[model samples]
Target: MKFNRQKREEIITSKKKETWGQEIKRNWQLYLMLALPFIYIVVFKYYPMVGAQIAFRKYVPAFGIWGSKWVGLYQFERMFSHPIFWKALKNTITLSTYTLLLSIPIPIVLAICFEYARGKFFRKSVQMSAFLPHFLSTVILVSLINLLFDNRTGVFIHIIQNIFGAKVNVLGDAKFFRHLYVWSGIWQGAGWSSILYISALSGVDTQIHEAAIIDGANKWRRIWHIDLPSIRPTIAIMTIMSMGSILSVGFDKTYMMQNPINYDYSEVLATLEFSMGTAGSVPDYSFAAAIGLAVSVVSFVMVMITNKISKTLSDNSLW
Candidate 1:
């Protein structure tokens, strides 16, 4: 069969194009599945990003985002010189660090306990009780805390005075604010967070455990060798993600719990931003934006650094 070279090449290219088109058509449902998420991202995420320009502008509500006067890095410069900004930044870091240290390991420990629980009913009940607080609104949680720890006629104070003839002001003190916030966060979130680890643990191969048992490995040995190895990837991934989000401590709870007495210790970037938004004769849009941008940039850098470290150390990373 004699074939023209140019015609053969054209035919080959045409066949490739048809194959590609058919593959796309076959996966049309997948494309459709992504449509809603794509639309959501475009509408809620990307669309709002247009206003990020306000970070660079002296935003005026009357003039709108585009009409605002450009102020360059004037806000950023001012932020660097502001003492309150540094204080807020430091507070944010300290709170985040405390929360990370206290909160991250708790879910893992809970997952291990739940996995080892003798009775399914007991385990489920415990899990349900533990997870209940996570569903509570920050306002409700704070109110509950306040009620329990109120300096006057509080349940905790009453118990302390009755049992030990001592009165302790739990909420009014600055020293206890971070502890309260972090411990409450842990209590609320640990069980919910353990759900992922529990799922990962469930997916671990039972055959491996059986094999370890056959080898006469003890329970702790089996867990250390088989279970730990199986879940290490999940742990690494969660650790990296947790580290990346270390700066993003619970803003709602912190803001709600903060009072003038505890402001010295409790004031974080989010609360500072809130104060900046509501303070003065007019809104300090530039200052707020600068503060926000600085936070976002730091968070991004932290995530990148965490990912890099995770990749280097464990060969597991978000990227």
Candidate 2:
């Protein structure tokens, strides 16, 4: 009787194991669902990476990508030697740093505050207003910015000029570029970004909150010990993801906001590459490719380093 039971258990265990092909056949619907996105990524995303080899070549329109002369690191050398490269790098880093400082904390705070909002009506109304801006196209948003911050006819400038007897060209002034960029970004993104933290907060145990309340813990104390910690992992993951794009600040917005006066502060890597590739007398694809590749490399390194630090410090990371 013991031998017969052992044989039966062995047969069940063997039957439970599945090969890769067998699993796919068994759950064909799930694999079918995944196929569309997999093909889209390969075709639209990975396939284009093949052209990145142009960074090493002196691409000529007549010669084509493959027939172009392999100039090796010459494009990189030229890009680094150009004064605009360093200028753009400095502006990009400064702008992105300001954005990171505000973008990371503001959403978290917004989420926390809204979670404990006193009234559902007020909370939903304010959240909808905040989120509406995010749906606006970059061009429309920039156009609105230009209208509102115009040096002469702008509503804001008119108010300031009347109140202080001084004119402020918010868009034209290089000094105000970072301020406008970061603040506008907060306005557009904060509400939408807060949704992740809100989701995290929802999963926190209600029983624990009840116990904390019974023990005489105040709202602030409960939040400090409970809500904040509950969303800490989500915050860490978001930070790691943000680091991946730290160097690639929004191209369309930055380019649109730029004017001759503010070019010094607004010329980020994306715009720089764009101008190099298209704005010049003859498009320098190789140089532009080199700049983009460098930005990508640095951003990737930053992400890895941030993930390592987060893993070490809080045991929460993207990995």
| lDDT (0 to 1) per candidate | 0.83, 0.90
Q: Which stretches of candidate 2 lie over 4 Å from their true place?
A: 1-36
RMSD over all Cα atoms, model 2 = 3.8
Candidate 2 TM-score over all chains jointly: 0.89
lDDT tens per residue, model 2, 1-319: 9999999999788668967888788789999999999999999988767888899999999999999999999999999899999999988988898899989999899988888989999989988887898899888888888899988788999999989999977777778888888888888889999999989998999999999999999999999999999899999999998998889999999988888988888999999999999976779999899998888889999999999999999998876
For this target, which candidate reaches the highest TM-score against the unseen true structure?
2
lDDT (Cα) of model 1: 0.83
User: Among these predicted structures, which one has the highest lDDT?
Assistant: 2
Q: TM-scores across all candidates?
A: 0.87, 0.89
How many times do residue backbones clash in model 1?
A: 0
State the lDDT at 249 in candidate 1: 61
